[model samples]
Target chain A: MAESFEITDEMKARVGVESPPWTFEVTTTGVRAFARGVGYTDPVYYDIEAARKAGYRNLPAPPTFHGTPIYIPGKSEETFSTPLECDITVDHGLPNTIDGGKVTEYYEQICAGDTLTCVTKLASLDLKVTGSGITMFIQTIEFKFTNEDGKVAVIDRLKVINH
Target chain B: MAVTWDNINEGDSLPELKKKPSLTQMVKFAAGNGDFNPLHHDFKYFACEYLGSVLVQGHFRYAALGELVQTWLGHNQGGRIKKMSCQHRGMDFPDADITCKGTVDKKYEENGEKLADLTIWTEDNEGKQNSPGAATIVFV
Candidate 1:
């Protein structure tokens, strides 16, 4: 638990610094899994034939369902399965964190068989104290998903609250 | 009938999508999203113990709201989501109803594409808006 917290100059400097690019893959099985996980009954997310008939080349990724990151043992976060290299680590001493929110912007339709090169940047950092007197660090990270053809397909902003 | 820019009007409400996510469903979401965070599943995890129960993944609600929009769009026949955003205002527990709702805020033509801006959210069983959001969908 964080008794007190403040943003350091070093942490502030890390904002806007882009991390090394990582690969995120959109696959038929992955889209199906995510769609099923979300309890979607839409056939376009499960059957390629239905997807094609619906005007998609392959199974379409459902809303808010971005491609999964390529995970590598020893270089990935075991708990989250995210590439460790893409993390903009802040030494905020909070031990617990929660998802505060998310914002996703889509430029192109993301479908199965597409590989997106993703880059993340720390967008902003702020410190807040809750009504219950808990100190928290709010960090917003921006992710850019660029398709194989080099066109940016998606931009996601995720806000994480660490307390 | 498919929803089109010509038919959709401002202030229209989307058909509500209700969900009651079970623990097993949460596990499936964990596998699909690769977020094995114990706080979401392990009952003995510190955060879960501190919070009194396993909390639902915020993304789960976000995606639920997305599902609400997709269902209204006739599963791609009406249109596609161009932008979606949400703010998690409070924690939600599993096995409880999370009702997704939205209202069309505006409709306009931009750069030859017809688009509508919507105010979206997921409310708990008590009618408390736990996750309030906004979305933009383009008519195909």
Candidate 2:
């Protein structure tokens, strides 16, 4: 909890800055792992035959399961497995963080055997103080995932609150 | 039967998806989503200790809501989720029932496509709506 916090000019300048593209892979194993994690019993998410019968070229990624980022030893986040090259650093010296919310818009069906090039941009930043007198820094990041054909398939807006 | 745009009414309620996530399931989610946040799986993590127990990841509930929509749409059919959004309002602990429910709010067409907008949410064991959001689905 921060007693006093503000979004400085430097922080505002970070908005709209696009990060370098990173590779995200949607493999059969990745799709099945995500399906199993979500407790899905749908065979279309696991069986290639079932997926084909359902009109999908391959195992379909679950609605919210964006493909996993290609992980490298030092270039990826140790915990999240996200590529560090696309991370926008905001020098907000906050000690605590919380998940504010998320919005995902899909333009195409994401399936296994597809490779996506993902880019992220700092969309916006705001500061809010609660009635308890604790200041919070709210950051909204936009991620765009484009498939091999250079078509944007998924866009995700993630909100993070730091206090 | 599959839920088609023609068959679903504006006030129709989707079948509820009930989830009871365990510690092992949490770990699997951490692996599946690549979010190895210790507060979700490690009870001894400092944040978990502060909260008195390991908390379920917000994305877990988001994915469950996705499952709810997908199951209703019937994967064998050609329905697609055009958009889905959610806000994390409160913390949910593991081993508790999380009920995902939805109600169709509107039905319309755009550029020759049939669409239905629905309000969706997940409720904890006490019936408190912890995650509330909306989704738009397109029918073939």
Candidate 3:
């Protein structure tokens, strides 16, 4: 069942309102496997000492690692399974939402041994019916990551276009 | 390390980047980015629903721009990207070759730092702009 919503400017305005904080732990094996899964061989993503030598406090997860959790919503806890990066909205009966795009500013380095809490909120939604008879709803979502110190490490604005 | 700034006027083009869209490359991106969103990997996902065929993930093309910035500016070493944004203008289907592109719209000094105002995008097999965006690069 594909669920459809009436997208309006008000809906876009309602985007980014934070939901309950989703807390998760990322391990070194998790980071390495994820990096390998993505074809990124950057040692900083897997090797702790390498990351430390690279000036990162701990083995750092890749910039898009935060995306995995957001995409899947709720699924597995372990690291190296079938990297299920599917969108959670599908559970809501929505199909794939294309990312119109995003603008990411990496403020602080995310290091290993740090348990980060990801806070997500609905940002906005715009309904566009293409000339080709396809209806694309552009939904914007925002994610914020806070470390134990309450320092906001990363703020990501994700734009997803789903029908 | 600081990004070297040259006098780039409006209408200047950055070095263009070329790539091919492949299922194997798509899988690599899925593995590296950890974004195996099935819509990207499963042909049936597309065949049965949208587009009637598999399409490249939008981010994969944008990643090419990120790669260009890394290759040219040397990753985080190029000072700060400050702000960057792009939109999906078209689609790049599988097995099609494409190119990543950027242009210097203007150059100026801000907050005592040199900056380049630029536009970027990816072109599909037919030489059409697929993903387009603008960026501000600050040099130390």
| Candidate number achieving the greatest lDDT relative to the actual structure | 2
Tens digits of per-residue lDDT for model 1, A36-104: 888998889999999999888899889887789999999999998889999985778777777889999
| TM-score for all models, in order of appearance | 0.95, 0.97, 0.71
DockQ of each: 0.77, 0.80, 0.35
* Candidate with the greatest TM-score versus the true structure: 2
* Clashing residue pairs in candidate 2 (N, C-alpha, C atoms within 3 angstroms): none
lDDT of 1 by residue, B1-140 (tens): 77788889999999999888899999898888888988889999887888889988888999999999888887557688999999999988989999999999999999998999999999997889999999999987
Expressed as tens digits, the lDDT of each residue in B60-135 for candidate 3 is: 7766676555445544554446556678877777778878888878788877978887788888767788888777
Error of 2 at A144 (Å): 0.3
C-alpha lDDT of residue A93 in model 3: 40
- DockQ winner: 2
- The lDDT of model 1 is 0.90
Question: Candidate 1 DockQ category?
Answer: medium
Per-residue lDDT of model 3, residues A1-163, tens digit only: 2234564454455554566676645667656755554445567776788777766677766644543342243454233222133222222245555567887665555656666777666766666777876777776767677877888876767787777
Docking class of 2: high
Choose 2 or 3, whichever is better by TM-score: 2
